[model samples]
Target: MTCVRPRRAARRTSRSANDSTALQALARAGYVASGVLHLLLGWLAVRLAFGSSGGNADQQGALRELADAPGGALLLWLTAVGFAGLALWQLTEAVAGVPGTDKAKQVGARAKAAAKAVLYGVLAGTAVRVATGSSGGGSEEGLTADLMRAPAGRWLVAVVGLVIVGVGVFHVVKGWRKSFRDDLRATGGGGVGQAVVRLGQVGYMAKGIALGVLGGLFVAAAVTADPEKAGGLDDALRTIREQPFGVVLLVATGLGIAAYGVYSFARARYARL
Candidate 1:
């Protein structure tokens, strides 16, 4: 009884510490960092539309752009800290239950949070690597290639593609239904709030479209027994560039992504801790 009590007390202490003000602040700042990265990627996508891209239209490309900016090194360090904080918060959420939710819903939500924690942790690691002069070599193409060489690699790649497609669809639905509101505090209805909602809807849908296309590429790669077909955001953007009215579609998608970035800044302020 005494040992069990102490262990329970330790868990409570850890949970309490996880909700610290500074950690929440850093987690919120992580949203801003995400916004910056999205904005840069959108800009790169727009540049692609004009046939004058200076870099890849993806997260790593965004990181490279950030590193080249004034005081970028310090900014990258801060972003790394912020992303780590966000990852920690997600991990905490995955471990702890939110009040009032049903058990099944809570389980599903926690699982999703756990997935987000992994993604945020990976982003944090990438930022740290870039800040320390590491190129952080590893592309989706290379990953697909490695998987191809392994047993049941093609099936694994197809599954990954399907998972990405599912995620993209989920994002689109979340934005369309404004389900993200559940994650925020009481944000009153007003011009600004409506604007944020609109921006989010556009942003999520655009991002979904891009991800959907990218995932399709992977699926195609697996079905055709070719690894060269799989690539990242840049490749996806290039694919969009080859379609009819491609310029217009690409520009609109880029603007939507930038809008999403702006919405993320608002989310940082209104999101529930």
Candidate 2:
């Protein structure tokens, strides 16, 4: 049947994508690119903690930082390609469930892979835009404005906020439980191995806290119908700076993010791919 042939071809393409060595390499590179972005974001957060208002402190800010550096354009292009490959890999995983897993686990794994695919796809698009010298898109406020303009948009925004909050909490739980280790090939060797575990815990917690704040802001925006309340990661950090003992807290958070960056590098090497 016509439908059967198409299905078979789709399966074949999925198999090819799953087994591609070049794609595996690129996915690793995507992790490295992620590391670079997180490190920059952490540094920017620390600077913000110190009352320095030099950078944006989010994904876009990280890209801008890279763009300002020497040979940044080439690096950005490579990073975009890497993230695209990662997105493709995850997409394949989402379409074709992992082999030899129980049904429940397979469902969970596929859903997670689908989420990762979306995340990497967005990053790839952003990187490409930055590399192309395009500007003025992807601002948190801008996104909020657009979202709120739709019918039942306030409710929609609220649901999105809730999902983000849920995701943040999931990250916290995952870090606390050390479940991320399941994704790795090996923890590490000796002290380095132990260090990776610690880094992952701290890093996940830090990012989770930040995401929690960001999600809270979105919920606030929805409730107040004020787009200004919703913001990106840099805005989240800036908000943290306004809290009691925020200076020290923000510094700690920055260090934790940097730790995550380092752990990401280890992941680039040890991830199950």
Candidate 3:
């Protein structure tokens, strides 16, 4: 009887240890997956922006290019895998309620909600555009033109653009105050200092500013009833193409976006669940 009791106790202890180990492994996997998703999304953004479509036309061109480019294909695959991993991680985290997780969970939920809203909005807009028989196919200007041709469409487009820009600005600001400092500290590797960090922060702000400007221009153009005045990155590119430094600007912007992808990769790899 004494021997049997001792064996039973040992088995219970081992089972507890196994359970704990499994829980930890699950957590680690979850965090890694989230990071990977972020990286893939970032890559997708870059591919769409810089492909032959001039990163301006949000159409099937980018997807086709991604399918063709070996590197882009790999990134796309990775992105999908990463998204799955992130979803799993977020689900686990939500269930476990990890420490200091409330804010992250809330933010994540909001992001998902916002993304769904955008998706629905885009679909609805596309339907309207198709139904109305607008001329502009995929170009930002074309989208604006299509919308503007309708009686109340211009205001709607402006509102959507403004809302998008506002959301982007919020991400930039929140990301800077919370995640930016930590990311800089992690990536600085001695070469980065306070000034460098500040510059990076400014760069994030600049990105937000660019988005905001693009949004405002979209709104203004709509209000003026002139889609030609709707200036976006595509317009910027077109304007630059006529200038002496066109190639230089194009290359610079392309490289900058690529660098951003790398940054996103790093962020995903190191993010704690």
Candidate 4:
């Protein structure tokens, strides 16, 4: 009886250790993949905002060419898969309770659920719409122009900006209140890597605020979108330049976004798992 009890205890300990290792690996992999995806998307956004493409035929051609890349498609799919996996892992961790910390698991689970709910809701809605064949299905050309020309287009943009700002603030508060700070302070942590993590959080919050501001401006400018002005990069740049102190703010925001992308890319390349 004594011998059997000892063997059972050993088996349980080994199993627990293996589970911990697996969960940590999954979490790290998720972090790296998500960071890379964000960096890629951020770079694309900043480029489109500042580039000379201006929504012309040439620009459209370039975009199509890039979109055709197999690597880009793979990355897109991988990111979606990674996000789903991460969300599931988080939920599991929360339910089973993460080793070494219960609070961390709870906070992570809540965030994961929120993120999954939003992403899944949108994706599911899109899938339903496509399956139902609701649209007449024409080329999406001029959609941007049409929207920008709408009476409340600028206002719509501003509302989106405010929403982004709200999200950023939420993240900032969550990070400060959660176990992230303690995680950052652990022995294997700190130094440039920790700084980078902090920077990513800061950048995320900044991005939300920037988006809110940009959306508001666009909404305000809906009335002024000249037929010649259109909804191209040229018009966007021109509008920014014409607004009172808008250009400086826009430029700074653009750089902030670029920095976030660079940081994410660096994290993907060098971070553990």
Candidate 5:
């Protein structure tokens, strides 16, 4: 009994350390890193809208841009650490669930936290790869091509497309309903808060549209048995550029994305960490 007591006490101490203020600060910084990434992507898209296609406007592109900045590698390392911390924090949330919730709500909260952990974990891995002078792997199209070559690959691709679309819809709903406010600690009331809300709404809507278009492309690729048709965010944006008044649309979307980035910064500041 004495041994068991000591062991339990040690575990409690470790848990408390993990939940330390420093770790929370690092997690918040991870949000900032994410915000910066979105800002870069938005800027790249804006440039593309203006017919300046100098680079790819995706995660890799954002990392590459970061690499070119002063102390870029160091920043990447810090970002990696921050994201990893966030992943760990989310994982803990997933395991613990939300307090005072019913079983179903608790399950839902845990699932959402698990999803966030995976997302942050991927970003952390990408940041590490960037820091190590390694190029990120193949395009989304290449992955789709590989999958389409397998048995029932087309069906799998379609399912994936549907999932993406669903995620896009969720983002739209969250933004429109301002459900994200629940995660925030304090949103300054009055003009500032209203402006922040507008940015989030616009940003989320733009992201949803982009994701919806990307999913549609994937579905088209599956239907046609042409993996080439499936692409990522950059491809989706390009497809938008091909539409009537596409330039205007793309510019608006780019601005919306930038607004989302701004909203992310606000999240970093007010998030209920």
Candidate 6:
């Protein structure tokens, strides 16, 4: 019994160490992957803004662009691992809950963490698929079309749209209030820190606006009963192009997204991991 207990203790210690190392590595890599994606998306959006056909300015497009670069497949694999790690980390947070918070707050935080886990997990899977050269066609549009064909699918699509809009509003509020600062270990005082904060503010608002527009498209799809009207980030940006002074708006928004990418790099450095 004594020998068995010691062996179990040693195993537990080793497992804990491995977990810590894995979490730290994943957190850093995940942030970098996210930064790269945002940077690519911003670049594509900017090109589109300038009347250049840079192709889709979304996650899938970002992956495809990365694949075209040297050592792209390897990078995608790394990104996939990083995002998978991030998903696991978020899942851990969801399961363990944040430290030193009230019940309600903890529940909310955990829920958010769970949602993030799903997002990262899906992104990781997509990256893996792209890396493997087995990526298929427009899944989002097809999914929307399928949903619309279901009974009461229009209402379901509308609900999804409303939820997305709500999430966009949340991001806008988070930026406006600078509440995201809470997620950081430190936001130094002075010009550099203040600049970073401003960048975050603009980035968040821009992203929020884009999401809001995307949600509106979904709602429109539901109303028109035309799944073709609904789209993702790329489509959302294109819709923005159809508006007045859209190119200018797109360029500004794209710059904001690029700023967010910079902020993401900063986050990798100072995030409360």
The numbered model that scores best in TM-score is: 2
Once superposed on the true structure, which residue ranges of model 6 sit more than 4 Å away at CA?
Answer: 1-19
> Candidate 5 — which residues are off by over 4 angstroms?
1-19, 99-101
Pairwise TM-score winner, candidates 1 and 6: 1
Q: What TM-score does each of the candidates earn?
A: 0.93, 0.94, 0.50, 0.49, 0.89, 0.90
lDDT assessment of candidate 6: 0.85
Residue 213 error, candidate 2, Å: 0.6
Go through the candidates in order and give each one's C-alpha lDDT.
0.85, 0.88, 0.48, 0.46, 0.84, 0.85
In model 3, the runs with Cα more than 4 Å from the true position are 1-65, 71-75, 81-151, 171-179, 182-203, 228-233, 236-253
CA shift of 154, model 6, Å: 1.0
Clash statistics: count for each candidate: 0, 0, 2, 7, 0, 0
Q: Which ten residues in a row have the lowest lDDT in candidate 4?
A: 56-65
Please identify model 2 stretches exceeding 4 Å from their true place: 1-5, 136-138
lDDT of 1: 0.85
Pairs clashing in candidate 3? 35-268, 49-55
Q: Residue 256 of model 6: what lDDT?
A: 84
Instruction: Estimate, for each residue in 1-273, the C-alpha lDDT of model 6 and write its tens digit.
Output: 999888677656544543586686787789888888888888999988888776688898889899999999899999999899888877777766655568879889889888998999989998988998876655567889999889999999999999889888988998999988987888777988998788788888888888999999899999999998898999999888879999999999898888888888888877777
lDDT of model 2 at residue 95?
78
Cα lDDT tens digits for candidate 2, 40-155: 88888898899888878888888888988899999899889878988988888887776555887998988988999999999999998999988746678889989999999999
Q: On residues 133-201, what C-alpha lDDT tens digit does candidate 3 reach at each position?
A: 443346667878888778888888888678857965965684377446553325545654444444445
Per-residue lDDT tens digits for candidate 1, residues 152-174, read 99998898888888888988898
Candidate 6 matches the true fold with a TM-score of 0.90
In model 2, the Cα lDDT at residue 131 comes to 91
Which candidate would rank higher by lDDT, 1 or 3? 1
| Top candidate, metric lDDT | 2
